[model samples]
Target: MGDKVISERLVGTSTVHGRTLEVHRLTWRDAPGLSYDVVDGATGELLTVDESFDEVPRLDQLCELLEAQQKIGTSSPRP
Candidate 1:
């Protein structure tokens, strides 16, 4: 889907195979809800996140690991 870019940033970085692995979270327009991507740092590949729920300030929630984001997802999406 071709969605507008709202925000993107480096969540963290790590050393993998002697290369800098940058963890990222990219948010795109998804109509009423937003679409986010968790890409692999080293290869810039998409990581699968099996989550779907209404949450506002989604960026903050996506910034953390999957385990840490469990508690959030009942709010509303941002405009």
Candidate 2:
């Protein structure tokens, strides 16, 4: 079978640039590590999928990712 999802839990919520985001922790049975996803609280859109952590990431790390996501979203598109 393909990689089965082991768990997915909402860590908490964080506000970045006046927008609220839902942070989630995702683990897979076949994967050696876990990942974190940031979703927009209002629109329920997935923003970031970061698989760089082998363990539970700290809140500050999630916040940093959110900040970076916000910056990318607000940047002007190149022609």
Candidate 3:
């Protein structure tokens, strides 16, 4: 099998309750893909996606997103 390529970009954001929400656009190489999780920086609460993307995402793509999020001052909540 060929190495699959995954990429992510910050698409937009939405406000929830009273927090600044960051949105990410994820793209995957093929079918039979993966899912993602969002975590709150302050309260350590995990947030689920309110909607689904047109394509299922990949693990690497999610990791890249997490990295980008960290650089932008957002991070996964403490587990």
- Most accurate candidate by TM-score: 2
Candidate 3 residue runs with Cα over 4 Å from true position: 1-5, 32-46, 49-52, 55-79
lDDT of 1 by residue, 1-79 (tens): 3366667666565553344434544566665444444444545544334543233324334445333423653322222
Clashing pairs in 2: none
Model 1 bad stretches (over 4 Å): 31-79
Candidate 3 local Cα displacement, residue 7, angstroms: 0.5
Cα lDDT of model 2 by residue, 1-79, tens digit: 1287678888778776677877777788987677766677887767664333444556676677667767776322211
Task: Please rank every candidate by TM-score, starting with the best.
Answer: 2, 3, 1
Winner on TM-score between 1 and 3 is: 3
Estimated TM-score per prediction?
0.37, 0.60, 0.38
Question: Which clashing pairs does model 3 show?
Answer: none
lDDT of 3 by residue, 1-79 (tens): 1145376555544444445444444455774553344544345543433333443334444455545555665543434
lDDT of 1 at 49: 44
Please give the lDDT score for candidate 2.
Answer: 0.65
- Pick by lDDT: which candidate is best? 2
lDDT of each: 0.44, 0.65, 0.46
TM for candidate 3 is 0.38
